[model samples]
Every structure is written in structure tokens, then in C-alpha cells.
Target: MAFVRVAALSQLPEGGALGVEAAGRRIAVARVDGEVYAFADNCSHRDFPLSHGEVDAAARTITCEWHGAAFCLLTGEPTCAPAFRPIAIYPAKVEDGAVWVEIADEPAPAEKAGGLRSLGI
Candidate 1:
């Protein structure tokens, strides 16, 4: 796996997530309090794009708009219902004014462990 440039820092909202493809996998890059984070773009519950979700910089979580599931940005752990599984978080960094994500040809086996379930909240 290697770090690949995805988007320009200036293009990402200060408290938002951006969907991008890295190593053919959908990834969400988020910015919070001048820092950057990356995780699987697809929500664990409904497989919706988490990039379209809302980011809570204060809580360090991203909420899925489809089902209102929230996941920790740093750990990718589910923070609420409608989603019990954690997302796959990838290594990310900001350098040269660009957002870089360390993506692999295939998500790590651990990252492939998420399950989908629509437990109505």
C-alpha cells in the first residue's frame, strides 16, 4: 500500500467529507480542526456513501445521512444505532497542500470484516 494524492486540501470543506477512489476502493476523506482523516466511504449499515454524510468536528464523528448512523473518524467505530459495525479507516495525511491516503489493492482482511444490517432506529 502507498499514499496517493486524492484531493487538494483547499477543496475539502473545513468540516466535511469528500468521496474519492483510491486503489479502486471508495474512500472518504474528511477534515477536522485542521487535521485530516480517511475511512471507507460506504456506510456499514446501508452501504451508502459516507462522504455524503455529515461530519461533527467536535465529536470527531461522521453521520450517515441515509440512516443517521455515526462513526468515529479516528477509530471508525460505530457511535450509535442503525449501524453496529465499524468502518475501515485508512492512513491519511496532508502534505504539499494535498490529501493523501494510504490505500491497498485490497482492503486489509480486518477492514473486510464489516457487516451490513438495517436495524431501524
Candidate 2:
């Protein structure tokens, strides 16, 4: 795994999220209750950018502005209907006042033999 620095801890305000692109992937970095969370920036419902949506800090959910789908910030699970698919969640850690994400290596062909074979490893 490789850790990619996306932003500083102070860059994201509480109840707010920042859109970042790293290694050719769009990611949403959110800060809530003094903690930070990261997920794929696109909404599972309609492929909309979740970073443009509203963050409900109290509920720990992000509401997609395009279709009203709500997703849990902690787990990236859809809390509302019309979005049965979950967004890909990434592991985030803070070091030296900077936020870094753990990126998984590309899977081997045998390891992705199932439907995951389409993952393009």
C-alpha cells in the first residue's frame, strides 16, 4: 500500500468536505467531529459528485444534490433509497498535520477471477 497526501487537517472544516484528485481518482475528504473520512467523490445513485452536496454533520451523512440520495460518511453506505450501491471507501490517516490515504495495490489476475475481474487489474 502507498500513502498519498491529499490535504492538511486544517484544510477541511467541520461539517465540510473537499474534493481532491490523486492517482487519477476523484476523492472526497470530509471532516466531522474532529475526525476525517475519505470516499470516492461520485455518488452511487447517479454518478454525481458528492463533494458538491451537503454534509449533515449531526447525522454523519452526505446528501447528493442531484438526486437526494444520502450516504453515511463513516462507512460510505447508502442510508436512503435509490442508492443501493455503496461508494468505495479509502483508509485515511493523519501524519505531520497532513492527511494521507492508503491506496491498495492492483490485484493479481487470480485474485480477481470472479466478477471482480472487471476491476481491470
- TM-score for each predicted model, relative to the true structure: 0.91, 0.82
Estimate every model's Cα lDDT from 0 to 1.
Answer: 0.87, 0.76
Model 1 regions more than 4 Å off: 116-121
**What local lDDT does model 1 show for residue 2?**
91
TM-score of 1: 0.91
lDDT of 2 by residue, 2-104 (tens): 8899998888888898899877777888888877788878777667788888899899998988878888887777898777667777788778998887666
**lDDT by residue (tens digit), candidate 1, 69-88:** 89999998899988888888
Please tell me which predicted candidate would have the highest TM-score against the true structure.
1
- Per-prediction tally of clashes: 0, 0
What C-alpha lDDT does candidate 2 achieve relative to the native structure? 0.76
lDDT measured at residue 15 in model 2 versus the true structure, 0 to 100: 85
Residue 88 lDDT in candidate 1: 87
Residue 86 CA displacement from its true place in model 1, Å:
0.6
Worst 10 residues of 2 by lDDT: 112-121
Runs in model 2 deviating more than 4 A are 107-121
